[model samples]
Target: MGVTLKDVAAAAGVSRSTASRALSGSALIAAETRALVEDAARRLGYRPNRAASALRSRQSHLIGLVVGNLVNASFHTIAEVVQRRAAAEDYQMMLSITDADPRREEGILRTLGEHGVDGVILIGTGSNAAASNALLSGGTAVVNLIRGAAESAAPTVLASDRDGAGDATRHLLELGHRRIGYIGGPPGTNSGDERFAGYEQAWRDHGLPLDERLIERGPFEPSFGSDATGRLLARVPEMTALFAANHEAVFGVLPALVAAGVRVPDDLSLVCYEDISWLRWWQPPVTVVDNGARELGELAMDLLLQQLERGRGSVPQARNGRTYRVGAQLVQRESSARPRDV
Candidate 1:
């Protein structure tokens, strides 16, 4: 038989009630006494029955984390960070992968709700506002990460995509590349729209003519990247620099560049958004704008905890919206340089 609260209490010379309170982390228990009880419990290997505790407190101590896909390095980092943070807080995390499908995301949200999760954090599919709102209305706290649903008012955490993209564009512009090509994501999404806006804004700030023909936007896939690279190269053969704003697409972009016999920082300077370990190991290590994936995950967890502590309904609604942003940084590498003819 496992060690029980009675055994721990006897070991600590405290009552059974005191041992239970201390293990539950009650504020009413004196610090010294609580420490003593906890030490005794640990020595006795007494594990609290989470099922019994949940029955008494009505808190499952479980948090649900949902992401579109793990293909994006940033999402992978965010998932790791959040899981670590949740475990540190003594909360178990349930992870769900939806592949960015709206129907799948909606079903996951509904199932998480049915499971009585204490809270939820998700990279929304942008089409599941109704399901998210239902969770909120049912007194469950929801925090949106990376992508925000248009109709839901859940607190959101995001990286500064616009600022990061602008910084990347400025880096290429500063290197004397006027004819720059851009490969980006589909329009209407937060990252896609804001990143393109940032690229456009940087050109305007530099007083350079924006060339529409050098831009390509499509799904975040390797095939899209390869096809887009071919089309951009054919249309703008004189393009001296390229910004691959979609990290997933860069996989395809690199192979296409190799097939075209383009040498990095020589034939065409390249900059990518989002940092990954392999990026630094590549020949002519790729330059990138670091999106602060870990920081974004930490901030998202913090916001969710705050809402949970305040009681979801008690969290004051923001006048506009509660959105937190982690800043982006530019990391230079051997992949970018001044245009050869410049």
Candidate 2:
């Protein structure tokens, strides 16, 4: 038979009430007594019953993490960070991947809600407004990460996409590149819009001519990256440098640059918005922004826990909405330099 609370109290020489309070993590229990009871419980192989605890406390202590795309490194990092943070507070985490599909996201959110998740953190999911909307109204507190241009009532946390991209653009300008090109995510997507806005802001700040011919925006695919680089090079031969929208595109852009006889920092400088592994040790370590995905995850969890602890009404909402902003840092590296002519 499994050891019960009675066995634990008997082993610890404490009353059943004291043992129950200690096992339930009641603050009223003295630390020494709590430790003694916990130690005795361990020695006696006594496991607390989760169902009984949940029934009494009305807390399942489970947080659901929803990622739009599992293949993306940033999302994976966020999930890892969130899981760690949740565990620190004695809460368990469950992860669900949506593959950027709004329908899938909606279904997963409903399932998690039905399964008694205390809260949820949603990573970017393209333009899935309905999913977010349902989550907000469905009585579950939710948080968003890396999402821009979305009308969300949830308390959101994300890296500053505009400022990060602006920093990258300004870096190229400082390197004396007059004719810069840009390869980016699909237009209208939240991330794509904000990042591209940053690219535009840099040019307006410097009074540099915004050349449409030197720009290409498309899906964040390696094939698009490789093909876009070729097309941009062909159409705008004088372009001295390029900024890729994300890490996945860089995977394709780098190889295309090599095939086109483009020497990094010498023939054509290149940078990407999202930092990834291959960008770390390439012949030219690509200069890029660290989007602080992990930090955002940690903060997102904190926000969710706040909702869980204080209740949804205490989180507050506003005309502009509530958000927590995490900053992104630009890691300058060998891939970027002054244009050959400059």
Candidate 3:
């Protein structure tokens, strides 16, 4: 017969309940007893059935983490931090990638729900309110990361996109770049809107006329970045600096600049939003406004832990949806400089 708790208890010379408590690391059991029970179980090759224990305790000890995609460096940091934090707390993390598609997000949420995850941390697509709320209404703790869904009541953790973009714009402005071009993300996204607003605010702060012709808004794809760069260069040939607010777009921006025979800082200075490792190694390096991805991930885990503590299967009371913002900082590098003419 397979080794069981009863066999372990006999070997440890204790009652079955004592063996169970000791193996489960219950603090109520004495240190010495726990050691004895652990030793006995190891010697007898007895393993506790986690599924049976979860059934008894009503906690799956699992957390679900959903992200738009792993391509963004910020998402990569968030996944690493959340996974480590969940492990430290004895919770298994289940990760899902949704490509920012609402339908995919809905399906992932439903699957996580079926798995009975105790809580979820996700970069919401801002269009999956129904799926998210259904989980929350059923007592599953949910914490939104990065983008947020307005209709969902879940707490959110985000980087200060407005402040970060403003910093990038101001940096270019300070460097004597009068005609600065901006490449940014799509309109409806929270980060995209806030970043664009910050750019406009910076121009207003500097008393400069906001030139609408120098701005391009599109997807985070390299093709969009290349196309936007072409349009800006063609439309505003005198543009002295470019703030590539979309990180993914920077990839396309650099290649397009090269193809156009534009030299960094000499002909055109550049500043990008969000820091990734490769930015520091690029020829001449790249200046960036760093949105604190690591800090955002850590804070998201903290918020989810708070929700988990409120008890499983209990809905949170109605209150103003709370958002926690991580600070952003500008990391200066070789890519930005005073315009040659200035």
Candidate 4:
């Protein structure tokens, strides 16, 4: 049999991670351990044909990357990062979108399996945990970006959804607006729930009562935001400020408000969850929670590389699950202000 990573590990009396780091030329490995691993490889007549090793291990060096709700510009940021990272690691990424549908996620994953992807990176708003668990059980190396899968399955790169939401809500509350409306993303998404939780927590902390009628669920799409804005306006016509869950939703809400002759900030203030590029150049601009999209994407790629190295030659325990969280920042722009009646 050809020499394997385990063979080198055994010969060098070092862990597989040590062996991988040594071979991959990472700076983190100890000099002595690196020398030992190299000596063992030479002694064992081990020539690492990366292509062959990948094939023998049933890893195609192709990772199936699934994204949901691409309408959110955040996904576009993530796609760029993932592709760049994949290229750096000499791997190929296959991209697909599910539009946040569970059935579609399943279908796409099944196709990925047929096409021989060794791993997957699922990026979305964290709903299909059950389906993600199924993928884990099938021996596909899976990582989650801005979403969470089963706790026992893969590592997650999560953005600070709660912090961002709380900041948005607190901004409005501090502006002396008591009658604030919240337009959130779909019920199935963890980002939506976590953000709404932050909204509630902010209100409770400030001794403000949360009116159920003031909260509305809209999918992560501009059209849904428009529809939800209309419904909330009809229910509570006197609402002075709105906290929208995402940039796309903000786009929807802003146009509707303008069409209704509602002066932004002067009449109805808006705080949204993300910083899309066009927001800076918009007529009135936008005050939003920056969700650290680029950082989240970069760190996610790092975590995926870690998994690939750690889980290369042996089974990993469930306790090895990892998470890297990036915090949120609130960017002040022109769209939010003190209430008109204040």
Model 3's alpha-carbon lDDT is 0.89
Candidate 4 lDDT by residue in tens digits, 1-342: 888888998999999878988987779998888999999999998777767656766677887779886677888998888889898887888889998777888788778766667678888546555555565666667778876755435778888898899999999999999989898876656687789889999999998788999998767778878888888888998999999885568768878887778778887888888788887877688888999999988887777777677653323454645777899999999989998788
The TM-score of candidate 1 is: 0.87
TM-score of each: 0.87, 0.86, 0.92, 0.79
lDDT of 1 by residue, 157-236 (tens): 88899999999999999989999999998897788888999999999999988999999998877889999999999999
lDDT of each: 0.89, 0.81, 0.89, 0.81
Number of backbone clashes in candidate 4:
0
lDDT of 2 by residue, 119-198 (tens): 88877564655565565566577887776325666766767888999999999999899888999887777668878999
lDDT of 4 at 59: 76
Model 2 regions lying over 4 Å from their true place: 1-3, 10-16, 30-32, 126-138, 259-261, 314-320
Best by TM-score: 3
In Å, residue 227's CA in model 1 sits off its true spot by: 2.8
Residue pairs of candidate 1 with colliding backbone atoms: none
